[model samples]
Target: MMRHPFVLFALGTFAVFLLLHLAGGRQYVGVLSGTVVGGAGGAGLGLLYALAWFGAVLAAPVLLLAGLLDGALARASRARP
Candidate 1:
């Protein structure tokens, strides 16, 4: 059975969370301006922030273009003699 895109995205997100949690458990800290803090938390937070920013900035245009391309391809296929 084909899984939905959102479902796949959720699974991928969960897997990344699990991997990050297991790898270090947030003991280490990421360095910024020679300061130390929770590494996993900092990295995870940054990654999530970046993903959210990118989704906001690019998701709509990308999806719209994908839909238009799919529609065009579908039309071309149907036009085939």
Candidate 2:
């Protein structure tokens, strides 16, 4: 089966969430507590937050580098005979 990067990212994010829930109970509780006071809603809200955080933390850097590499390659190709 072919697994896309988004699928992998989501699965990895959920796995990290589960691991943290199990191992970093206190820290997770603190985060949840803050979110609760800030009026964060159900699992959907949490998932959205997780996805956004993962995108910012992980995906953004990779995307930025890909863009930079693409630009550099294009510039190099244009400069070729």
All candidates' TM-scores? 0.36, 0.47
lDDT of every model, 2 decimals? 0.52, 0.53
Tens-digit lDDT string for candidate 1 (1-81): 224454355445556555555665334333323344555666555455445445534564465556566667777999999
For all predictions, the C-alpha RMSD in Å is 7.2, 9.8
Residue 16 shift from truth in candidate 1, angstroms: 0.2
Q: Which stretches of model 1 miss by more than 4 angstroms?
A: 29-81
Worst 10 residues of 2 by lDDT: 24-33
Alpha carbon lDDT of residue 12, candidate 1?
53
Task: Superpose all Cα atoms of candidate 2 onto the true structure and report the RMSD in Å to 1 decimal.
Answer: 9.8
Give the top-scoring candidate (lDDT). Answer: 2
**Candidate that scores best on TM-score:** 2
- State the local distance difference test value for candidate 2: 0.53
**In model 1, which residue pairs have backbone atoms overlapping below 3 Å?**
28-39, 29-39
